[model samples]
Target: MPKAKLKPDVTVFEADQRQQEAIEHLHGPMLVIAGAGTGKTTVLTRRIARLISERHARPDEILALTYTENAAAEMRTRVRAELGGSETSQMRVCTFHAYCNNLLIRNGRNFGVLDDQDLWIYLRKRIRELQLNYFVRAANVGKFLFDLNDFMRRCHDELVGPEKYHAYVERLVRGELSIPRVTSSRDADSISDQEVLGRCREIDQVFQVVERMLSEENLGTFGHMISKAYELLNLTPELLSQERAATKFILVDEFQDANYAQVKILRLLAGEEKNVFAVGDPDQAIYQFRGASSAAFEIFRNQFSQSKVVALEKNRRSTTPILQCAFALIDKNPAIHATENNDAAENGGRRFQRRPLLSERDEKAGPAAIKDPVHAVSLTAKDAECSDIVHVIQQRRKQNACQWKDFAVLYRLHSHRDMVAEELAEAGIPFSIENMDISNTAEARDVFAIMGAMLAENDGASLFRVVATSD
Candidate 1:
């Protein structure tokens, strides 16, 4: 057999040495520590094209998993552009949830999965069945259900089932587990140990009921879909073997955002061949509260012991000043440095070391130099903060002769938007919120009422709503 040759049109050969190494790697596990603006997407798409062009793996056999649907779509489009639509038509590029959901759809006959809407409907109907001591009030029922759903989702992400949760609660009850004390005055409303144990018991009871209901109805939520897929792969040797054979290569983007369940699923799929390539930056990890592990690099290293690590240190998008400012801010967090050092010590002193980004942009060649890459301001009240922000934007617009489209206001929370929007509107400034929910708007409500009246025919409430909004 002759060795495979790369296609002449492939653009992966033009990448820098580190990126080229990651893209051209033929076998075994590899991790690429890609920083912001490091062309990680380029590396990923080019790697897929290279794999196909070199005849290492067919397009259909390669699986690319991303954290978001938009990222997956973008990756698919780039790969299609490289290899042509027809050649890459069968490639799998999707979110972790989407991949798991597809598997459950195809092989989860024993487990009937409930989507978000279905799960919401079922929980809304059966919520009252789970008797609770603290959160049993009628007014807080919605909050209780939401918190319960979130807790259960987190448990599922960690691969903890109802049985494990119940056992843990029992251990708490038996004094096998200790509760940490509330240290701050802000935690004055924190429950006592007895109350904490009581809540745990209630949660356990709720978990058992929900699991039983799912089992009886042969239904599972999106979280359950992931857990159930892992179960199928682990317990069924034949299915696992078939899946491993089918998926020859696995490439994960934004790997730091992957939870334990997703990581476990990938491990199972990789099997012994371990043709897994993950690219992500630990500094960009922001989903820890939602089960994304902060020590994702360490976890990946531990799992794939033979995996080679590569770093993309060039900052191709940002200026030198911006990179320097970011580095300074991040350096204040000693915990990150400590973790990196410890990981290096544990892994034969060959960690994916963090280095200052080398910006490709020629700062001196630009028309205007960046005077201040970062600015800081402190305001006491929310109103004052919003006012100052609007004032700054107005001044900047006037100075630069910029349009409204050139300005953007970002808030940490959705609650902050109302005040900022109020300030913007009062100043006669036009702005649009990115993910505003228009469903609850007056016009949307009126349209919904009209549709409801048309569908029901005899719905007096809907007709009344439509009539009330007409004038």
Candidate 2:
């Protein structure tokens, strides 16, 4: 493929100086610390466009990867628009899973990694075969199975193979051994080794059973795609070189969410050229439950020689008060990134080491000049709080044209859903759950729907649907 033409002068593209600096940096590895609403997707798309248009890079040679397909699609749309809808069709715009899936499909056969089948039935059967039904009630079996599945995936994400997993099991079984690889969570120190050991054994057994079944049935999991692809690349230098040659430039979005396997795979693809452009905000990482490591971004920045680091702190989405609230949380002990050091100026004046946040949005957002309109309401009892909320909503609707959907009640736990749904139903509220499609997966859930219909009208079918996916 021939190289594409460059984008026009500065006047053609209106962006912040820092954003332009990040986009213009088309050479070696570059890291952009894009805070929330700092136009991260915009920066990423524009950066890729600049690489193709201005830097004369072939579209097909560039790979832009995100954590989600939606984000990838959005980036593609923006990049195409930036490049005037020319020379962007072949650019690899996809999620990590999609990218890994493509690589495995084309080249996995030689590595004993072929196609994979559905995991839904395999999971249900495994739960029965392991006698997990006895340990967990039938209603909670789905939760047990799903949790086991997540544990297995996390293990694979950490690159813990079955043997090492079995080792963990053996040590746990013996009840006298030190575990390797301490968890990176803040709760790590407080967690009991035996508890972790028991869970590790459970995860290991699931891994063994599920993997064996997958092998017999010619099925593969998403974890297989990542781990096996890494294995394939490691065992075949020609394949690696070919892959690297095909994609001369790689742009990784949400780099802070990269785990051990992702970091390794990215490094392998980067090769000697190291033409990786990663963008992410460490302060916004919330996927650690899925084995994501924000430190991966820091490690990449620290290891790469002469890597350019750009901080995009300009807030265009939220009010200045909201930014202040968020930054207040981010500026605390663990939230503040190690790279941010305000005292570095006194130490050696090295690049003025600290990079603080800035908000361009108006401070008038919170109406500081006016007295607060907040009020307090006392309920007859704790249970009456629901009635109070419904009453307030009704009042708001009458006075301000507020719809039922205009109000929201967010809970941190799925366990909190049933109570809220019950309250809403009692109050005749028309609010809806954001993601209530759990029962849509697997045909066995049809039985669940039938059972749900047979149950009482107030049995919380919506909550049942959410839980049935796991069951």
Q: How much lDDT does each candidate structure score?
A: 0.77, 0.69
Candidate No. with top TM-score: 1
- For residues 1-471, what per-residue lDDT tens digits would candidate 2 score against the true structure? 555654453434457888888877766888788888887777788778877776547789999889876788888877887776684678899988788878877874422222112344456645666644233543677666666667667777877777887886797678667664345658777867766665566666666877776566455667777887787888899999999989888899998887778778888998888888888887767777777756666567555655766778677756655666666667662433334222343553243132345655553344443332335577778677666776777788899897777788767667667777788898777777876656544454556545654664533432334343554
lDDT of 1 by residue, 60-147 (tens): 8999999777788889888777665535778899988788878876884445444444455567766668767676853768766776
Clash number for each model = 0, 4
Once fitted onto the true fold, the runs of candidate 2 whose alpha carbons sit more than 4 angstroms away are: 1-14, 108-124, 127-144, 167-206, 302-306, 331-333, 336-356, 363-471
Model 1, CA-based lDDT: 0.77
- If scored against the real structure, what TM-score would every candidate get? 0.78, 0.70
